[model samples]
Target chain A: MGNEYKVQVNHLTKKFGNLLVLDDISFHVKENEFLCIVGPTGCGKTTFLNSLSKLYDITAGEILINGMPVDLKKHNVAYIFQEYSNMPWLTIRQNVEFGLRIKHRPEAEIREQTDYFLDMVGLTKFQDYYPDQLSASMLQRAAIARAFAVKPELLLMDEPYGQLDIELRFRLEDELIRLWREVGTTVIFITHNIEEAVYLSNRILVLTNKPTKIKEEIHNDLPRPRNIADPAFVELRRKVTDLIKWW
Target chain B: MNQNKNGTKDNKKYILMSICSVLVFLFIWELVTDVLGIFKSTMLPSPVKVFGTFIDKFTNTKPDGATIQVHTLASLKVALSGYLIGVGIGVPLGIAMAWFRKVDCFVTPLFDLLRPVPGIAWLPVLIVFFGIGLLSKAMVIFLSAFIACVINSYSGIKNTRMVHLWVGQTFGATRSQLLFKVAIPTALPMIFTGLKVALGASWNALIAAELLASTKGLGFMINQARGIYRPDIILVGMIAVGITGAILGYLIELLQKLVMKRGWRQ
Candidate 1:
């Protein structure tokens, strides 16, 4: 009751034409916590994130942000959708500045914020290049920059790097952890990859098949800047992997 | 962009075919005139005689101030007026229909019924309503252009990417803001296609109307020339129509290209 929780999902439920997707799922995140959600294909990990972002309406239960309700009109929530919605017409710089433009931020402030994020994502040089001209990984990096530029209290990313190759994906994951630490924003990232979840998250939320309920909350007691080669980290990864496989 | 060597070769082949086609057409025309000798010289003048007569008609203006330029301008004015009016009405209606399902449901059946009846088919009714004047001819062109614009605009907006709409909503854009800023910009390219098609159809319909009912347009001049057994004037009128249509089409293409340079052209 000390108001420690930054986001609270209380018994959230969702249905698509009587096929229940999320069944009374509940979770809580401390402020600035990197919470990774892992599940099988069609398992409603995205559905839960979408409900929190108000992209999809919950059938039942409540989602709260900062002790207040998750009202899309009022809350400062940014989403990185799985499908690349990066405006093809806009350059990388312009795409990063999009949220600021929508909020009507001052020109100087928008420019500083956008430039900082572009540099952070290592895409400052490609600022003038359009999305169609960039590779899939570069495009995803731009999307991350855009979401972080707005400086939202909550960042929702749905499979942001699942489309990239293994090497690029690992590099971007490292960049993401760095950015998350620097920004201190509560991130609810949804992914199906077990190794990525184990590598990036402080705590992992595993969801079961459709009518998805929280199967386990595996807190990675492994220290920060986690070493993937460490025996403990590998054990946790295998545990989460089996939980997902048999579920 | 890669060099289209195969396409370039195709283009060269087409150029040769077109030249051969022109020569063959001329040879066939000459044979018909020389060998058959079916029609009198007054009724169907040879292509050689037609060219000479065309030059004479231009070189020697009428005693009155009327010339070929007058007919060309008159037809252009009617086509422009009809085309503009069609664009004005069709574009907004299309947007509304695509955005609002209730409106689409109410309007679609009516449009479908009317669309199948070509602009030329409406000639008898249009002439009865408006008489054999500029207004009737313009009305026919308007009808032809309007349907194309509406369907183009409707499909353009309707086919907007769902992810794009989600992006706008996530950024806190209101419904009206999304429609004007996102949907319209995304739908613009398809709408341009509609406009180009509509423009061509309107031009064709305008000439058809003038030929059927008018007194001063290029089409009417050609019809009159046929009655007077002056094939040269008819050929000249045909050339004038073709040149003018080509010019208008080229200008529209230029405008589209310029707009496309801007990101919003899509």
Candidate 2:
């Protein structure tokens, strides 16, 4: 059971100057688990996620992926941020191929994976368009397609749809679920939206306010094609919101 | 279809207006010099006299000892050599300065010290070191273009989006990969801006050096005409300089368009 953990964070601590942000937080994400980390706004959720993604150096503690310290050089980790991070100079197709090209994957493999993901995200028709030429939803879709194209061992998403409208957000959330199920990679999705966490995750990690710690880890064994309007969904979301004491 | 026809009509109208404006300006200039004779010919030669001198100098090399074409070729050689060399070195140095802290620290003090000094101010020192030859005058232009290219390229790389860098880092790209794949391409528009500024500076610096010390070039031709008191030749030389500068600027703009036309923006 212990060996099955895909990601292990042990006493993750962070401090910006004298003010502590993440105080000795520890958690373990299981293999192929869609773990949603929901926290109150301004509760250092991004800081925690950034640390986990190795974008920021944690002051203390360690992040382990497949039972080793996080090393981007050795591990395949992909990240989708709150903002559109696609290189504006590259077309949507080139953006999707960026990581694969960087890793020097075989040409045929790169083309195959790129086409599959771009088609999967419904961006096949817009492949030649630049980022500025695309709408917000398409841009985010490009980011998702780019992340999944690498077939990452671990995928990190940080409020990737925070800027989208509710309709677009739901559409992307569903696509993310489909990708997660198909790829079966370990997913760590960070968001402040409780309903979003409930709607997408296999398990939800509820975080406390500043100097954040894991308030609770709830198992979300909700069946497929889960309805957000369903009573069970609303009740689970309420339970997470109640834990954070934030409406 | 109507909108397209109207747009074409508007463009033609603008072109016609531009031609008319130049004609009116030349008419006014000719009137002040030739028709009224209010100002002496030496001070401001008539447009007719200037145009005659322009054509005559193309064939005749009496005053400057070199035809207009020869002077122009010489000037192009100096300007282009200094300009290209500066871009080749300055662009890479600037990018390195921005991406590497050690390089930035080592080079910034030298850059800051030289930044305030005008490129023309280096002419006397360069003449002393290399004499009033192609090397010396080109060195003056090199300094001017170098500063511009470095400033722009450095600022361009520095302006790379942090989010883009993170994307590269997360995807397991190395430091050099982040630079080439992410930072440099992202910084391209600004780097082009630097190239444009560098071209202008190099041209201006070359002219100043030629006016003060060169034995050839449009600037030297103007200086030689000034010595012989032939305002016609001077005016022609000035016109040549203006036309050449505009043409060079247009060429740079064309290059910019060609390089950046990867459908970067609408």
TM for chain B in all models? 0.84, 0.96
lDDT of 1 by residue, B204-261 (tens): 9988888888878788888888777676677778878898999999999998898864
The superposed Cα distance between candidate 2 and the true structure at residue B189, in angstroms, equals 1.2
Q: Best candidate, TM-score-wise?
A: 2
In angstroms, give how far residue B245 of model 2 lies from its true place. 1.5
Please give, for residues A49-102, the per-residue lDDT of candidate 2 as tens digits: 899988888999999988899999789999999988988889999999999998
Per-model TM-score on C-alpha atoms: 0.90, 0.98
CAPRI-style grade of the A/B interface in model 2: medium
TM-score for predicted model 1 compared with the true structure: 0.90
Model 2 has fnat of: 0.76
- Number of the top-ranking candidate, with lDDT as the measure: 2
